[model samples]
Target: MLAESRFVDLLAQVLPPLEFKLYHLKTHLKKCRKLVFTSKSDKSVDAYATHFFVLSLDGIDLLGLEVYIYESREYTTMFVSKADTTGHYPSDKPPTQMGKVVQQLLRGLIRYYLPLDKPVRVCLFAKAERQYLFLGSAKNPLKHVLSDAQLVKWWASCLDGLKSEFSSIKKCALQIPGASEAAVKSYLPSNPQLPWTVGDIFWEGAPDDPTIAVKRIPRFPDDPKLRFLEFLVAEKRVKKVSRAQFWIELQSRQEFRLGTTVGIFGLEGTVDKHESLEGNHSITQKEARLLREVTLEGDYSTKSSAEYSSNEFASRVPSYAEIDVKGTLTTPVVKRTVETPQVNVLSAGLVRKKQKTQR
Candidate 1:
């Protein structure tokens, strides 16, 4: 994982478990390059498998960007690093806010990390509030003060790189008045969406089947795992307090099979059957909640605390899975019927007498 702190925090805030269906980080299969940002200092970037490009220098993460491919197209989620602390009461390293440093990271990302042949899109909600992006005091002009559209425009310009032919970029301006704003109104200029964008080709557009809209997990170009989970309150009226969202933390050991009810997560009270050898029983609400809670916190230790997990010791769904971690497809477990063996009869013992004469 990338060692950068701010970028990681940004991902957590934007893609909360309840709101989005998350998937495990798998080895990225696409052909790409690892970025090396060399300006004030020389740094080696770690292509952290899955959708992250983490640039580390001397063991400390300098920059982190969440990137992914959808139908051969690359989507750049966010580019972030530790907040700049150049002004009074500054930290050890605070050059991330520097104009030159920010340019190097963005320019290098597209020129190196991303594939050259395919189209790329940057789709993310950039936050307006930042302590470092502004001047700490009136006299300080070293810092580049910016907010909202101004900030985005600066980033877009940095991304354009050289402005040459074969590699030109067209940025869609954000619809905000008076530069940056806390809330975004909307994004315009409608464009055509890809086929898989809707859902699975097989079940997509099926009105009766609501699950058709979900994408699957283990999202290699042609991965076979078709397992996904769904969470519902299952009540007519749900109280705000009780209406909690559920998420499944993807893991290497976990194997999901469609329609196969696995063990419960952490149900409040349950002394009933855990799970039979043949998973044919239906899962109760309590049992589902157990799975929900456990999945939320992938490895929540009983005694020790964790930064991310403890921050929220809890972290989904029925339907085809969609990979929202960055953007891809998700899968759900599917059920298969097994055939029983044919039984042999003894009452037909008369056949045994005839077989002896064949020799």
Candidate 2:
């Protein structure tokens, strides 16, 4: 665990400045020529033409899953050691373990983003041959689910085959574009056997909490920098925003189109007290997408008050305005905890006791 944490810390160091822009790429069609080719082999499968289809009951637009990729050169690297207690590095040893864990988890993430009906192209610029090879085993099982014995044998075969493969491999040439050398090294396994898990990269004692160890990669004197490389790799350029940076960007480019009305067809907020009122307050992005006109309902706070003040306090409503989504709201609004709101709500007796103390 210590080693794993350290690896993640090092990874935090090497990734370049990453940023993502929402491109409605799906709406923009590309023009391409159709071609026919003859093959002699019995299994002459056209890999490019081969596609799989995935069906989902949920009305999620698969087109929205598409992301725009851009090449960037600005990046820096650092090492995070477990020995540094005050630092963000994991509290473990042989930090390479953390990389294995992260790679394992990333496999699932890649699988998630992949179109179920199509083979997704992963353009991995191998920065470290050994590291990429070690991580490559992780991709096999993801490509095809196999028995435990087969997995073990498959891993063993890679080791046996390494000598022949590495004969032509040059360490110097094994470079990943736009990432730091140290970052590439951090992905390697400590031993020949690569052990990985989806959950292993999470920081000990702070599972689910985003902050673990974050080392700022210093910029070069001449480079024109944009977003950090690590942020781009993690797909968090928008979601895992630092509070400080959000405020800075919020000051600029502030206009947002509502895309739909607050409550016409599908726009409605769930009333906290009354089902009817609660329904009025809750609206979904999907709902907003369907709206031709957007009318600002009353302030969420005022609605919150009005809903609770009404006799139908038994039902709790969720407000769309209170929701946090990337590229939607200018300022973040904290909603009532999704976990039972009653946990935070004070009882009349406790409220009186607090009031008495204040008096």
TM per candidate: 0.27, 0.17
Candidate 2 lDDT, tens digit per residue, 84-177? 0001111121111222222322232232222232222221111111111011222221112222223222222222222221112111111112
Clashes of each: 30, 35
lDDT of each: 0.25, 0.19
Distance from true position, residue 129, model 2, in Å?
17
Question: Total clashes, candidate 2?
Answer: 35
Q: Kindly list the per-residue Cα lDDT of model 1 for residues 1-359, writing each as its tens digit.
A: 22222123233332212222222222333333322112234233222222323222222222223333332322222223212211221132212223333344333333334444444443322222223111222122222234434443433343333232223333323322221223322221123121112111112233244331122111221111212222111432112111011112221213323321111100001111111222112233343333333323332222122223322322222221112222121223122212321110000000111111100
Q: Positional deviation of 194 in candidate 1, in angstroms?
A: 26
Q: Best TM-score goes to which candidate?
A: 1
* Model 1: per-residue Cα lDDT at residue 302: 20
Error at 286, model 2, angstroms: 18
Cand. 2 TM to true fold: 0.17
